[model samples]
Target: MKLVNLYPQKNIEFFTPDTSTKLKLPVVTNGISAGFPSPADDFLDSSINLNKALIRNKDATFYGRVKGDSMIDAGLSDGDLLIIDKSLEPKNGKIAVCFIDGEFTVKRIKIEKDVIWLIAENIKYKPIKVTIDNDFTIWGIVTYIIKSV
Candidate 1:
């Protein structure tokens, strides 16, 4: 399957609060600058060319950097960038990026009648079972793998 871009279209500005002076200072822009405003502005609203900023196609995708070796057997190594698509419905035996307890994790999803299992491709990691008590959310389905050359 192809990858999809899911980055938010809104522009986010970072600022630091000065407790001593009770003033707020603009810090930086998380997005790439298009030779426009500096980071010290009070208000900045700019639009990005989504088609140019991301790989546009029929599939929906977002970029994420891999953190561990849990998916090494699937050719996904540490520090690899993954393109995830939230629009696609996840099915049995699909690799998905899931959110559990406010943290993000990538794993192969296994659906049973009454059980949902998050399986890692590598043997070093153990599978996580989603129970009724745990807060679980499947963030997106992985569509493509992007890595640094």
Candidate 2:
């Protein structure tokens, strides 16, 4: 809660696996076209376990619920479920869930020559430049985002 207060926006959560639950859903193999409508292919249905589709390293993967629109342009809206992987290295232009001075934040990684900036996609929020005064660590790399319709 303290971390959420400090960040004001970007309240992120860490997910733990629930081994008791197993869910398998049907997936269509063909990619849907955004520009045109196409007939549904009933013959192209395959079962997909979410855990197998979304997760790579079970020990390093976690989920976080986003709480703000700072990343709306990046397609991460408030209340979106984020799949985070701690094993992935944080690279420039990758979205990352970061911990700074005991606060949690989700932002895009911007690597300058000598500075690292945590950038927000929305114009209302400014990029955060990491300095020696701040305590920062990249918690994880965001792999997928699930938004509610």
Candidate 3:
């Protein structure tokens, strides 16, 4: 039997302003905790609009679903929704979606002296050094990763 992907199989694409899905959820006044117990705050005190919170630049922001485990150590996994923004500068240590040799791959940007390297979080995948022979473009900077439960 052929297996179906529960997550979308397409490259993270740009978000249009007229997307049919828009959810506005309530945001607690206090941040959710991972440590000791805290008192519960009143409900509906504030709201967290994902579009506003997640997309800093709506026009340049896009979405792509991660396809592999090459970046597991960086907290990236298969099926995670990656939020990328073209407007953001690709700085050192920032994760980016890159286009190389006509293919798209996601990796962390590393600039060492005069060289550029696409470093993978997983050891199995070797870091690729950018050279004159390769086609490369820092498509966008990853701002957030939405993990699926």
- Name the runs in model 2 displaced over 4 angstroms: 1-10
- Please state the error at residue 91 of candidate 2 in Å: 0.3
lDDT of 2 by residue, 1-149 (tens): 11122223445666665433568787778867688888887656777888777888877877788888999999999889888899999899999999999889899999889899999999999999999899999999999998899
Evaluation by TM-score, superior candidate among 1 and 3: 3
Per-residue lDDT tens digits for candidate 1, residues 12-117, read 1111111223233333346547798657444544544433333443234456768779999998888787666677788999999887765678899999999899
Q: Residue 1 lDDT in model 3? A: 12
Rank the candidate models, highest lDDT first.
2, 3, 1
**What's model 1's lDDT at 51?**
31
Query: How do the residues 12-112 of candidate 3 rate in per-residue lDDT, one tens digit apiece?
Result: 33343333346678877677788997777764577666877787887687777788889999999988878889899989999999988877789999978
Predicted structure with the largest lDDT when compared to the true one = 2
In every candidate, how many clashes are there?
4, 0, 2
TM-score of each: 0.61, 0.85, 0.85
Off by over 4 Å in 1: 1-60
